[model samples]
Target chain A: MSATESPASTPLLAVNNIEVIYDHVILVLKGVSLAVPEGGIVALLGANGAGKTTTLKAVSNLLGAERGDVTKGAIHFRGERVDQLTPAELVRRGVVQVMEGRHCFAHLSIEENLLTGAYTQALSRSELRDALERVYHYFPRLKERRASQAGYTSGGEQQMCAIGRAIMARPAMILLDEPSMGLAPQIVEQIFEIVKDLNVRERISFLLAEQNTMVALRYADFGYILENGRVVMEGSAQALGSNEDVKEFYLGLASEGRKSFRDARSYRRRKRWLA
Target chain B: MELIFFFEVLVGGLLAGIMYSLVALGFVLIYKASGVFNFAQGAMVFFAALAFVSFQSWGWPFPLALLAALATMIVVALATERVVLRKLVNQPPITLFMATIGLTFVLEGLAQLIFGTDVHRLELGIPDDPLEIQGMLISTFDLIAAGVAALLVVALGVFFQYTRVGRALRAVADDHQAALSIGIPLQHIWAIVWAVAGFVALVAGLLWGARLGVQFALTLVALKALPVLILGGFTSVPGAIVGGLIIGASEKLAEVYVGPFVGGGIENWFAYVLALGFLLVRPEGLFGERHIDRV
Candidate 1:
């Protein structure tokens, strides 16, 4: 997997043979394996407590601090072993995570929050100032409110700030945990649109862990369904979106009514709901 | 008996206040980086004075003795970081505070064990002649001490504001995890802050030692820092200096004017009383930002 992630078609991140145990007794992730190809958004779909956040933490190597031990397994990013590295080291290497909650330094100005994103990058003062100007281009709302303290921002703005902070690292890949967890539908759409834009324009890979299966699967190129700490299903986003079992369980469609719709042959053929 | 005598007392008090600020800066540096209220800071001052005196009396030139004393303080800071503080890094703040209290005892015993309990005079290499400025009779030593204190404060400010390490220290103060995530090494920053704190303590020791010879009594002067820290915010550099000046002046004046009303020893409680009054008005201190944590 590491060797195949070439400059042309490298999987941005590959998680293989990973196991996470809490306190040596209770196991959270049991040998979860997944790969996110470059220039694609892959959603790790699961319900609450399905270890989606843990999987993201394991990939970022941030679980060791919380007694969530990655007992075995390796995470490779841009064809380099990244499993044992600390979060600080990972940030430097460009595998930044936005985390579950926004976790912006609330007391800091919006500008300071962004500067912290480029914390590991030793850029000249003029270069840092220029990079900050570029960040404001993506999230213009943030630019308008740059001098304001982060705590005063709305939840949606805070989420934007969080993503902007990760972008400041100029990461090749980003792990987003519950980016739309508590946002309103309108805000969720806005955040997802920004994510899509980032993926399409910047060519940055994204591995998003989300409970909102409908919204996540809609935008993702590939999808992995995690249940009870294991990958119960993996396929291209289109295939998983139309699978019978996925429709019944993930999309919350009543099994009795959409029995035929469950086995969608193609996105165009599944037109009953569209009509 | 008149207003002229009161003016004299006021001037002396102000000089004392500046000295107190120098001592308080040591606590501020250590606390900002490590979040540990260092009880050993006072002991560090005493030890620094002892080193200075030992070097001068041992036939070293004045400049050489000063350098040797500073080097000793640095060694002490490094040793404290490697031995005592390294072990207590992740411990709770209370536990770390207690460890510092233990450090105070160890340092006191070590100083006594090495230098003995006898008092030693400290000559700051300045002329003992008095200078008359606008009819105020000022000792050259007091003026020099105050000047040294001002210069050190400015140097520390520059070191923290302009240097890479200084920015790293500020990041640590803001959020340790965030700082670490950015690869600002915690252990390295801790060692640097302690070394700088040790340097400040040595300067403070030299000044105080000149006023009252290097003895065990010098260690007790560290108690004066508590008020400075309380009145000035613990994390604030300028606050510490300002708080120290306020406490130093008021206490000296209180000991003279107010002490007559109530027996004597008003200096012993005057600083505390001032701090208590400040706390009642603003518990976060004069310059401390209001810090409220959410559950």
Candidate 2:
């Protein structure tokens, strides 16, 4: 835990002073640390190659697959050290990552895809049946296309299947990697709404990684801005949305008082350092 | 009399096809789970029969020899997983395929060294007398082999279609990373699949050795399953069976009717020619999934 963190309430998931190196040489993430508070959505906002996906993968311990390792840092899940756990063990502990590009099992039927998600749960027959029903309930479109092969589903439906499959695991925290990539605006909105609903109803915490700053800030309770492998700024969503520097740089709204995106951001950076 | 001879040949070819399918089933099981082509599978069949016969010659009873063969196959599976497959996980399919080729040499040499290079016969207590039904001439040995192969295929099909481990195996087959992300222990799955493949190889070996003596040449017979695999598919068990049956029948027919027309012994070339022709039209084989690339 960080020295500055509050003692009143511990975050459900926390990462401290993490450094990640890929292929034993190239560094990708430097001193990155963040937390997902219990039952809250924490958005890591960044553009491509900003290390947002790396951070999420580090948390889920999937970095091993890409020859990336957390060289220095500690990860704690539910206040217990989990930096060493395998991805499967992490899922059994109620943490799962729905990978980027919506990695649906294309050969399996949509329903079969969802059932595969419950592999670790060891649910009874009746319970498994109920879980499938619940997934269908969350995404009625899934039920309509449940028997259809996942590969044939639309991009929107595949994304829903990905999330619905994650949901079937009954995860306490979902490290969702880029939920809004390559989707229509309306579909993105629908997915965000469902995520918010799931958060409210199921009390499942989320650490969402996304490039869409405005939309992520719209739904997230707290946000962190990543730029070039570093956390450039961090604030509550409302505060960040209202901040003049963030508006010009990320929100794409030029504040009359601020000079330009680059100048205003650096100025704020300097100010932050000075303080 | 000619028609009766034709039907007799047809049934005999089918039984031979079933045996080929039996060997291919072992290949399919390992391929489905690990995406490894498992070139060592044919070597395994040769090794299994050789070991079983060796144990029997050492004065062990039939049951003891059978158990010892099963145990040897299990050890081979486990060792292969640890020493070979596990080390090469996430490698390109070609690299894994090449590794299995290396494994084939190692197993074949080991089998020859331990069990000696001489040929040996396997007696499964099944009498080889022809069981004639009216005007039909059916070899009782062929009938027993067909019956055993059918039962084994059904047992495997039901196991994969209905059980939890079967679902996990399919999950691993569908996508390895997705299976891992969903909390499936991929290493355990691979181990289990190799074990299943070993068992299937043993059954294939026993039946084949019962008919033809257990020799280094049995490895060549094991290679014959590849054409059957091509005709059916590497991923589908039923496809293996059907491919086996078709190749079996076609080869027998080719050897009988066509062989007289064009020198004798067309059996060797016939099945492969059929597989090659199938490849030209339906490249993925009959039941294999068509390769689809998503942009």
Candidate 3:
């Protein structure tokens, strides 16, 4: 089936014909377009320097820092134009980016770092107390180490803290950039499980950028293939899994050496004519 | 012969400590709000006091002079933020520190150019009569200074704890990026911090100027605040007060008793020595969080 007309047809976010240039000269993302359905996990798979992370950043309006300029096209969130809004304003609208490298404030305590996630919420002191309790429910390990400084936590713990901090904002969607980068295979599995749980339970959409194709397809219901800053192919997870061409190129399994079931048909036709 | 005198010195030291806390409070406010060390604090104090003196000299009532002086300090603060600090934002912290030092020189030059480089008496509005409290003689000015400092502390505490804007300021102190993400107007919060810092400096200036004639020497009192910040922790409000009191009282006692043996100037190094000892004991200062790192 065509990617646009699957069971997940309703586009919660639409990136319409976007072009991003760097420093008014270098063209990084060349006219890329994609859509994410509500409560759906969309995986954008690409090699390094394919503008995958840049596309995610563009959606969050966090491109200016990396010298990325959206020269053309726009990103629509919840049927509203969101490309013009600043990153902070976009965050208020429930679009949170769990940036790569797990940026947690090292000097602050874990509890303090979590509180910072609710920076935009105008909750009462009692309500904030309740929210804190809710966060501890999801991350009991953090609760145990709440008073401890964030720097003392392990990499996996820091990643958890980063995710928990983003969740504290009560985001409707989270753009996870390389969530499993530099993690152990065991830890990666656990992290992906948590991501799925968050999506299923909280109904939060996820746009994940990852290099692990098999792992991504294992969890993602739908996926997009990005090549050289463009969406080359997109389809349901199962169709893309079985596509012969996709296997040859992306799945690292080539059909070039395999014989086609065609020469036998010609030989039978010739024998029938002789009879 | 010496015991009675020692008790007298001790009482005097405690009172002086309270006064030092008042001055240190100004440093704490600015440092916490903007992360600017604000070396120009002493100049703000001098200018505020000078303005008050000028108003009083013009035959204005004491309350009128105080009100006018406060108004002037606010204006100065607004101007400083707009002209100097606003321009310096996003610069390196060291660059900003250097800018403040330059500001100190400019303000001193301006004060000298305008008010002349000489001492002028600042008449304390309170009656200049001494009061006897438990066989100790307390000058009315000391009582008034202490009372005013207490009021300042309480009011600041209320503002920080209860007000929305004050909470935003605290958030800014804790994390600037997070504060901006929350839509806290960075410029407005910074301006407010400066205004509050100016107000604190004015109070300290007036009290110190009244105690020892309005002159550049009153600016020197800001030096004592450094040790208070060091001992109390750079970011703690209560630490500033406690640090100040320790510095003030110990310096008073040291000058009184250890002066003969050390050939005087014990007051100059008393706060530093105390700070050194405190650092040796608790490197993070009294109220600062203990820093830890993971491998």
Estimate the overall C-alpha local distance difference test score of candidate 3.
Answer: 0.78
Q: Which pairs of residues have clashing backbones in candidate 1?
A: A5-A10
2 versus 3: better TM-score goes to: 2
Candidate 3 docking classification: incorrect
TM-score for each predicted model, relative to the true structure: 0.84, 0.93, 0.74
On residues A158-269, what C-alpha lDDT tens digit does candidate 1 reach at each position? 8888888888888878899899978999999999999999999888889999999989999999888887787777787899889976787678785577645436445423
Q: Per-residue lDDT for B1-295 in model 3, tens only?
A: 3765676677677778777887788888888877888898888888888888888888999999889888888887788888888787657788888988988888778877776776889877677677776666667777678788888888998887556667667767765644544344567788888889889988998888878889988778888888888888877788887777778778889998889997998888888889888878887679764544555
**What DockQ results for candidate 3?**
0.19
lDDT leaderboard ranking: 2, 1, 3
In terms of TM-score, the best-performing candidate is 2
Instruction: Estimate the TM-score for candidate 1.
Output: 0.84
lDDT of 3 by residue, A81-153 (tens): 9998877788789888887767666666777777767766777788777877877777787899898777788
Q: TM-score (chain A) of candidate 3?
A: 0.86
lDDT of 1 by residue, B130-196 (tens): 7776676667777778889889889989987655567667657766655554445577788889889
